[model samples]
Target chain A: MKKKILCVCLISVIYSLVFSACTKDVDFNQINDFEVSPVVESSLIFLNEPANKFYNNGVELTTFQDSVAIKIFKDKFIKDHLVKAELVFETSNSIDRGFNLRVDFLTDTNTLQHTFNFSVPASPTNSVLIYNYTEVFEGNELLSLLATEKLLFTLNLQPGEAINESTLGSIQLKSKGIFYLNIDNTL
Target chain B: MKKYLGFILYLACVIGFSQNKQILYGFSEIPQSLLQNPGGKVDNNWYFGIPLFSHIHANAGASGVSTYDLFADDGVDFNSKLESIVYDLKPNDFFTINQQHEIFSGGFAYGPSYNKNEYISFGLYQELDAIVYFPKDYAVLVYEGNQNNINRPFSLDHLNGVAELISVLHVGYNKKVNERFTFGVRGKIYSSIINLRSLNNNGTFITKPGDNNVYDHIFDLDLSLETSGLVNLTEKTDFEPNDLTKQILLGGNLGLGVDLGFTHQIDKQWYLDGSLLDIGFIRHSKNIESYELKGDYIFEGINPFFPEVGSGQTADEYWTEIEEEFEDLFTIDTVKTKYTTLRPIKLNASINYAFGEKLDKECDCTSEDSEYLNRVGLQLYAIKRPRLPQVALTAYYYRRLFNGLNIKATYTLDSYSFSNIGLGMSAQLGGLNFYIMADNFLEYNNIYDAQSVSLQLGFNYIFN
Candidate 1:
């Protein structure tokens, strides 16, 4: 019985020793100091196509503005050509709804001595364009925040006019962008 | 008697070191102050948290080995400190300490949609985790010397199997229970595995002239002491018993969980965001009879290692009684006590600020109502440290062009125990958003490392 007890005691001692070594002492100060660095700066540019809609009144005020679509209606006084032109236009979706006129071709060359007749579309009615006489088309269309009105009536010549294609080579309309909008009146 | 009592006391202390908290997805460890926040419109909430499922994360089953040395590495000082705290024991006893633990931990959360009066939102969320540990070793002692000069050193080694897994999921909803708070939750699933073996060294025996104990046992060739005319001997052998307590068994487990989040906008520029994650349970779906294994083991001359061998002669009659007892101790009829319970939950919170012109208006001077609703500019989000209740800072910058291409850079500091860092990216187009992030870019480090690399992926959606 004594021998048996001694063997058991020996086993117990070994077990106890294992437990003793398991303990560890920790000192918070000695660990290496670590800091999170800032994220590397990278640049990216994304463009969002504007929602499809037209300006308040589709036409622009100035001829210098690009969206002007002018069509010449048939006049009995002129032969082989439609001389009396009634401007039928449509503007982009924008609140400004205006256009400008720069009569360059009219002064540079003359095809016939004909009187020019122009009339504004009815307000809040069937008018496809709105001309804002006050706002002007600034330089660098990409940088300028052109009011939607300028994009509406800025057209210069008829689509099939031979000189219209060459003289007015390009028609461009641009508007400033808007992203996330949270408007709280109380705040 | 006193020593035995003291040993019991030590065991009690070790088991009580930390209250084991099971881990599941979507549970938050964040304090009550942040969790109770009411979500609102125009709020993008963020948070920081830590894993509490140390047991499941360190489980020995998945790794196929015990992590007996994980915390016992050379650099740590827990050894010295632990010695001062435990009861006294001899050197041989130290050999048996199973320095391994089981672990199963994960984290997750999603926010309410960003619109007031209108409760429709496409929130953000994710979850991932793993566990590993070492196996335990058991040894038996033998006697050779008569009443004196008896000595033994630990000589046993073993390997334990281990396993780990992680998953993330979320959905959309509209409806705020209150004007200041919007409550939301997410669902997740996880899985894991474990296998192990115990080895003994003094199994062979040889006849050598000895002064006492005239009888020769199977391991007599194994010298207990050279001076005493005894030779130390060992033979290549393997053991796989069928006893519930001693058997080398493997098991697979799975569970379900949820994540909850709340946000409070303290006036656009400043906001409080808190989230709770991983609340769930694991059930052992399989039975114990499912554990089927097959292996080969070779034994030297006369298998005297097991009692009831040929009576007083050479290897002739095989012993069946001893082997039966072994199986009884190692195998279990049912796996009723095998599956673990609930997993640990974590809490997260963050405060963010935006740079540049703050668009808080309904209409601009140009009669433009939508101009104030752009997602351009830079924002900085600061998070608290991990492990300890401290704070860490992170930054994110966003810019967009006329085209649909959007670019951004974001940095985050992980938990406080070690050095941890992470980065994230996201692109948004016509209601389709995609995101990716790499955490712990420096290199992977467990929670024990003061610095490490961790990664996460994200996605978002918007409805018209």
Candidate 2:
């Protein structure tokens, strides 16, 4: 009877071990649809420069001395990635004026540069007018600009023939950029 | 970005390969096998585990893609490889890591007339399990940005997973009521040291061309993250090893569970067995913290004309206003709440045919004629998950090589791999027993391409 009991016990133990060992079946492809939160956002402000220059007929507003140079440090989104930069130009004018706006991007030693030009329409009333221009920087152009720490933007506004001395308007050229950044959370 | 990628690579190195241990299933007469099914036909008078050296198991795996698929030196640039991974991945792909160790476990049985026909056993063990499914939609949106997938809503339902670490103390009872039937039941007390879970999340992200601006981005999110004992660690600047050790032992949360198993012998050759394990829940109340994000927000780009530029407003002030507007749109609520988490329950069933000569008796026992030297069997296993139950089927052969040696081999079919092969060996020297088991043997040579791999080994001293 003792021998029979021991044999049963041994068999029971072995069978149970077999069962436990065989039961762990993991399917890596069994999961679908997961969550990620808070996408990254990166922005660079260029010409939030304060200026009160009144423009007359054929008068040009130069931003050389009043131009702002902002330092953009290296970040995960700013390195080796394409940036969709949307530049917005804001001007507060008191009278109807046809103005020419010229923006220049100056890099290392002020040698490397890129330029963008826009024509602003005269407003019927004295109010702040906003103009938006979007450009995508990728490949060599993006890499070259990202390599430099400091970015300088020179804004020049020329009042067109629509404005005269009596209908003069004060223009403050403000430019800011918005870039959407991707945050990698694979970790 | 490099640091994040490096961390993922490091995780793969530490916990990336794992497979089911089909080889050890019914390989030999080891004492620990009783943990799998208390009603199994094997029983010893007493057994002592070799402290921390006994019963160490570790496994890690990825489902849809392997490391080589992304990082191999195939001349293709890194960007293309990443693009393929993000775009070509299936919705069901996932990554998981699991580990269990017997800190110190030993069990003894007492029964009628020393036959141990009806017996009681007990032991203790610690376990850690973690799993995270790959969110393909979110990956693509983050990798390429919403510029390409504009107007297409990306669902956030895929974000769900759990990570837990706990210690279990259990006591079991086995009874032989008739000539052909044996039944066992185990009651367990689970002391949970850490728990982190995020499940049932729902949200969507969409971007469309704006009428007033270049693009309009919208986010509809409802998500929550819950934690227990480890919540305090988030406030700490640095973590000390000793602090974690204390939590793992008896820090905070607790729960109860049970295991049931039975074996029925058919005539002289056939046997049937079934078991259900870890049917329980953990009540998390200590140091509890839950964070929830539940709202919708739309951003139509920024206006440089805001505050009228030279109206005595600094750039910092302008940007701060934008930040405040965003904060008000999608606010995160943090609260302390007690919650309960159910354990991932497991079920197993098997059938066995015993044959061949009676094995040599290593100890002085009364019933020597009842031992079988060889056996063949088929087993089915399943574990409950948040989405569905994971299942696997296995076929195995067990043989006693000699008086003190035994071996088992198995072939398994499961979700991760179709050709999973396993092997297990057990050797008894005097009264000391040592066993080692591994699965997915074919993938060991080229692990970078294999989806899963696992290993388990242990030592114990048993007496008849």
Candidate 3:
């Protein structure tokens, strides 16, 4: 009787073990892929003029100067406040360009101002540069002020270049703003 | 929401009954015997029965994590570096980030029979979870040009919670033929309910300039900038506080299930058992929303010059434009869903030995009493405390106190899960025999954390 009981227990044990082992093992390999569906909401801006610069007199705008100036304005209902903006430029042909730029906002008048200056790369080929900026409307400052308002800008673009009216081509201001250079033909 | 309220009222009404118990609906087999013998009316036939009849029969319990308890304390508070730059700006200056609100829940299980072949049972369970955090003060700031500008201030103070109720029904049967062979099976049914809710708060404020602190922005800009009076003229206005509102959500699902078990006694002293459970899924209804926003802000104190409109615009018109321009600012069609419970299926198998005489051979006694357990012998079967992998040995010492009463204590260890110690008695009176058992002698497992505990009362009627 003892032997029979032992045999039955042993057989059952072995059978259960074999069955459990034969069953599928838990797969712990994690296969996860993060697909950030590109938000159609975000925008990408491109400059039509690759160089984004001009020449004045016998000098180039790439030369360092005291300051530079430009006019800015909001295009119709497209309100643009200076939330955050930066100027990005790259040097080519091993030419070095050194400069600085300062920014200011005239909230009451709804205009942003640039009173600083900076030099661009003096590379022979056309170099690309960008001024990136952003602004957030706070309180009713925006709702009431911008219900149907236009944002404008006044920049001081100073360089050792030969300043002229046609030196910078048609003021291709990406934003609803104007650009200008103070230079005389007599000089 | 009305239906949910009605159901809650109904539950309150049911629980109001003094006799209403914390009923476990899963294991109905073991308790059947106890319910029948509560007044102890057994006599005669039970005296000739084996003491082993007093073996334990059932247990019910619950176990799981608290999603609400863990998540409720997650409110957010906003802090800004710009505030630090402005020396006059106090720590309370920045607007807050929205609070984190969510609901989570876990489940339970109950077992009613130890000697699987003799019982059937039922169990019921429920859970409620509520957790959310409210941010104090914080807001997002966008930089235009090189200056800091404040956007609309919004810190969501939302509410989210979930409640669940589940009912399970089960039945098991056991029979021994001749002297050794025994077989059994169990059937089950399940049903459940889930409720959840969400709310939102929105506001606006203006930025002010001025600092009374030593490490203010004016100081930092001057030190790093080397330009005196660079921010001497920099100015901002104080914030004007405004309105707050909320929103609500509703949704749920249901399900069905079945389970079967079997046991066999290979010999007079050896037995084997196994079972499968929860083989089904719960279905749910799609979610639906039912509220909208209702307030606005006035910026007079901050901007004394700017005009303020009291109530010319409707919430709809404002929100529509806000959604069109800055859709990310406000969450539209936010949903809170009840997660589906994933019940894992279980299979059980065990071998047991009875300490009595080997009933394999024929008995010579002809007396009616001798023909019963007397022929098989009256030795007690004591339960074993240790668990030996693959093989578990259990015994009970049965003592017959009266003509129809037999008492015994049982100890069992389900190697796959945990062990159980049980105590109970069986009484037989002619055609009606009843047994009652309370498992876990010393509370190795309780109504909460233990592996499993159950009370089983069973009934058996044999035809001559």
User: Which candidate number maximizes TM-score?
Assistant: 2
| Candidate 1 lDDT tens digits, B410-452 | 4433222122233333334555444333333333322233222
Ordered by lDDT, highest first, the candidates read: 2, 3, 1
**Ten contiguous residues with the weakest lDDT in model 2 chain B:** B11-20
DockQ of each: 0.01, 0.07, 0.02
Better of 1 and 3 by lDDT: 3
Q: Tell me, by lDDT, which candidate is best.
A: 2
DockQ of 2: 0.07
Single out the weakest 10-residue window by summed lDDT for candidate 1 chain A.
A38-47
Tell the DockQ for candidate 3: 0.02
- Of models 2 and 3, which has the larger DockQ? 2
Which lDDT tens digits does candidate 1 get at residues A62-178?
Answer: 222212111111212121221111211112222222222221111112222122222322223222333222222223321122111111222232222122111211221222111
Report the lDDT tens digits of candidate 2 across residue range B282-338: 899887888898878776543333334357664445556655667765687888989
What residue runs in model 2 are displaced by over 4 Å at the alpha carbon? A1-117, A120-187, B1-21, B73-79, B232-245, B302-321, B329-332, B359-370
Give the top-scoring candidate (DockQ).
2
Q: Tell me how far the alpha carbon of residue B215 in candidate 2 is from the true structure, in angstroms, after superposition.
A: 2.0
What TM-score does prediction 2 earn?
A: 0.72
